[model samples]
Target: MTEVLVVGAGPVGLALAADLRMRGVEVAVVERRTDPGAGTRAIGIHSPALALLEASGATDGIRERAVRIARGEARADGRVLAEIRFDRLRARHPYVAALPQSDTIEVLTALAPPVRRGVGVTSLRQETDGIRAQLDDGGEIRAGVVVVATGWSGRDLVYRPGAVRTHHYPDRYVMADVVASGGPVARVHLERAGVVESFPLPGGRRRLVAWAGTNEVTDADGFLRDAVAARTGTPVDIAGASTFGVRRAVAPALRRGRVIVVGDAAHEVSPIGGQGMNLGLLDALTLAPLLGPWVRRGDDAGLARWERDRLASARHAARLAFLNTMLGRAAGPSAHAARTMALRTALRGPGGEAFTRAYAMRFDRAARARG
Candidate 1:
């Protein structure tokens, strides 16, 4: 029997399968699409994720192709509000690594088993011993556990009705990656209109994002250039751009009998803070070791603990993403000033280090230790 049958071959699924194989667990991965590596959707991999990814030996490859963001700045109205240094974060990798999602997938794919592309799990049925999965290509897979990592696209089919709750935000934004010179730092400009964020990528390129304040955008390149110049006084030569809205979704439970859920399938958060993908990667990292033992020995205790702790971590990440989204929206002068003050206080002295650790997603580590 296959120890673990991963239902999606995305980053999360690949990471989980890779780590499980490293631990000598039998695993198989299936993807619904033949090609899932098309976009640069997520770009920031915090220290916690980097540290967790070290087990699969993909962290070094990722870092080699990523820009290490050592610090971040918060500015508003042409004045510096606060500077948070990531070097102070207590982790093996003390910086946020910025790389296109495509690059990240490539690195992990090299380490994972051959993914069965163009194959999908149409349905899952629990058995007395193992779970049986029906594939879209008239095939079947029987495994000790089925992990749903198909992300938001597979939420409806993998989860029961009323199982997952979703909340959509009114905020809209446009972002693009272009050839530009930038340092190893990230910037968040809290303008009177909205927040403008810029991050350094590999190959001397930079990713720029600007909030649109619920307005429909027709010209992405024009809007990105105008917003960056207007808010941050930086002229950006954008080759192209894409617009996206934000939302938060979470399932109260991550496990249902022999079937389990991970990544965006279990919890989907806003992209403002760049925690959604990292949370999912960390999910795979945290679950791999526990899942192996359960699959081999039927040790349900570890899986129980894993579900409880993962749910707590997902909730905390969602709350953090919510705060980040709210803070980036358009604000008045007084509100901006208050936000700056709060940021300044939080990003100073001892609190600065603590905030950096929190932003690096050390809460999961702390929770695991406490558990």
Candidate 2:
């Protein structure tokens, strides 16, 4: 029997397998996709995650292709309200590393074992000494432990009574990646209409995200361009755009019998603050260390504690995402002014550094202590 069978070959699963391989643990990876993806999807790797990924030698590769965002600016009506400098953080990786999800997967894939492609786990059944996983390929694999690292959509494969809870927010946004020159600073425009955000990308490209109220938009590019030009006075000629809604999901228990869950399959948060992937990556990092002992010596003392700590981390990330979406929501002129003043006060001096640290997801207990 395999010691550990990891489902889903996404960033989280790949990361977990890589960490396990580094520790000399017997790990197998499976993915539903026949071929690797090519798009630059999720784009932020924070300090905490970077520290955790150092063991797998992924941090250096990610930094090579990523744009380091060391500063964040909050503006309104063409005026700067406040700024958060990540460089002030007392950590090894102070900046939030921005790389395409595709690039991240490539970096991790090189470190993990060969993944079995075009196969999917249909269901999982807990056994006395192991878990039996039913695969779509008409075969079953029994492993000492199984880890479900699939994303949010793969929740169905491991469904149990009261396993997961989900909630969707009414917020909507239009975002797009374009070839433009925006310096390596992340800028947010808190306007009366809504919020307009811009982040620098590699190869002279930039990403723009603008709030679009409750109603859906058909012409995402036009709406985004208008929102940016009207609110931030910056005209953007985008080739295309996409719209998405935010949601949060959490599993109170990450493990059921011998089968465990990690990554988005275990918890999912809004992408407003770019915390979802980092949270999952940290999950893999923390779980990898514990899985080694459990699988090798049957020492499961840390499993319960790991679950509790990871649950708390997920809740904290959800709260942060909620705050991010709320702060960027549309407001009246009076509310906008009040919010601007509040931001200025909150992001000033020492508070700004603290905010930057938290935004970079340094509060997770498993993260390395800052020097």
Candidate 3:
């Protein structure tokens, strides 16, 4: 029997499986999709996440394929409002590494246990000694522990008997990849009109994300081109475009009996600050060490501790991400001015380092512990 059965083969599940296997635990991973997801998603890999990737021996490969961003700038009306210098960060990997989520998944998948593709856990029931997972393909898996990393799909299976609370923001974002001529500084333009963000990706490609109010954007390329040119005075050659909604949710608990949740399964935050994937990666790193004892001794106490700690950390990270979304999507002259001034003070004042550290998620005990 597998010691642990991971129900999703995304970055979170793959990271967990890799960590567990490295620790001598027998693990299996399952994914519903036969092929990997395409496109560049979650472009920012913060320092803490880089540390976790290093532990799994995946950072070197990822670094070779990622762009290193030394600082992040917030601007309005073509003027810089605030700057967060990631170069001054205390971590070993100071700068945020900009790589496509697909590439990150490739690195993790290479290090993880071989995943069973086109197969998904349909349902799970806790047994006396282990959890029994019903697969979509008429197969069943029984493992000492089951980790549901399906992120939002299997919430009904893993949430602790209570409804998960979710707050959906009115904001929508149109994102696209573009070829631009600029330095490697990640930038956010909080204009009175909308929010436009640019992050340098590997190759000559850069990712641009712009807040598109309630109106549906029919032409993403035209929209991004106008927005990027207007906000940053930088010309962009649009490559591809997509849209996504902004929302935040957290399960009441991260553990249910012999099964636990990680990544989007446990919580979700807005992509404003690029915290979602990094938070999930940290979840895998922090949860893996606790699983060793639970698998060997059936220690429910350790699982309980993991649940409490991770939930708190997720809440904290989600709050930060929400704040970022609010600042970026600030509308109207009064709100925009207030946000610009606040950000300027926060970034240029004595508390700038603390603010940047917090936003970068360096203060999380789990992240610091791994570092």
Candidate 4:
């Protein structure tokens, strides 16, 4: 049997693979996709996750490639709502990096060699000693441990098909990421109509994620023009467009037998807080330490510690994702009252920093733990 089988090539799987390799553990990763991501979905790498990447000896590449947003803001109508500076909030990694999910994965895959693409896991059986997986390629692989990073694809392995639990909201957002050829774009810019987030990637290309509407945005050009028009009263062009749904789902536990779930598989969230990938990254830190001894001496204490120590954090990540999504859709009388009071008390003054810091993962205890 192999040391470990990681069942996805996404960021979570690759990251876990990297951590395992760093600890001198043999690992193999499988990706169902034939290639890297087509567009940018997950953006904004926070300070905590940056530290994790740094520890893994992969930070220099990402740091050199990504654009830094010293601060971020949330706004409404024509009035400026809240502007919080991430650089000043925490001292570790002073800025938020704006990069695409593809670039992030690319960096990670390079660091972690031998990711099997176009390979899908079909079935998994676990015993007291190790686990075995069936690949759609009509092959079998055995490992002492297997991590089910397959995302929604692995739901059946844990629960009945279509039985995964999820919480969603009515509000939706349209997103687009493109290379701005003109000049260095604004670090973090948001208007009442929506928000524009930018992060530079390797090869002089920058990634941008913009949310132009709360409801279904019909006209791509119109939304771009309107977003710029509403914010700056000027015209702007949207060179590329990509749109996807926003959702939140959390499994009760991240592990069943030797098969463990991480990243989008264990928990997924709306893009409101930009914590989805970061949550998965944290999974590496929290779970990696648990697998070292298991691989070194064929012991299970390290693996058990991984589950025990990481469980609460995983649940909290899902819970926070839920709260952030709900807060994004907060409306009607109750939401209005809350937002209004928030605007009156916090958003208008220095208290505005508190709201921003809380969301930026700055105000939390030990915010540098890969989340």
Top-TM-score candidate index? 2
Q: Model-by-model lDDT, in order?
A: 0.85, 0.87, 0.84, 0.66
Report how far off residue 195 is in candidate 1 (Å): 0.3
Per-residue lDDT, model 1, residue 52, is 75
| lDDT tens per residue, model 1, 62-81 | 98999999899888888877
Better of 1 and 4 by TM-score: 1
Any runs in candidate 2 off by more than 4 Å, and if so which? 161-163, 368-371
lDDT of 2 by residue, 246-344 (tens): 988888788878888888898889888888998998888888988878977899999998899889999999999999999989998889889988888
Candidate 1 runs further than 4 Å off: 366-371
Candidate 1 has an lDDT of: 0.85
lDDT of 4 by residue, 29-134 (tens): 8888899775666766777777777756767777776777776555544444555667676457777776767878878888886988898888888877788888
Cα deviation at 228, candidate 1, in Å, is: 0.5
Cand. 2 TM to true fold = 0.97
Worst 10 residues of 4 by lDDT: 182-191
Single out the weakest 10-residue window by summed lDDT for candidate 1. 362-371
RMSD of each: 1.8, 1.4, 1.6, 3.8
Candidate 1, pairs of clashing residues = none
lDDT of 3 by residue, 19-48 (tens): 898888889999998987977888888888
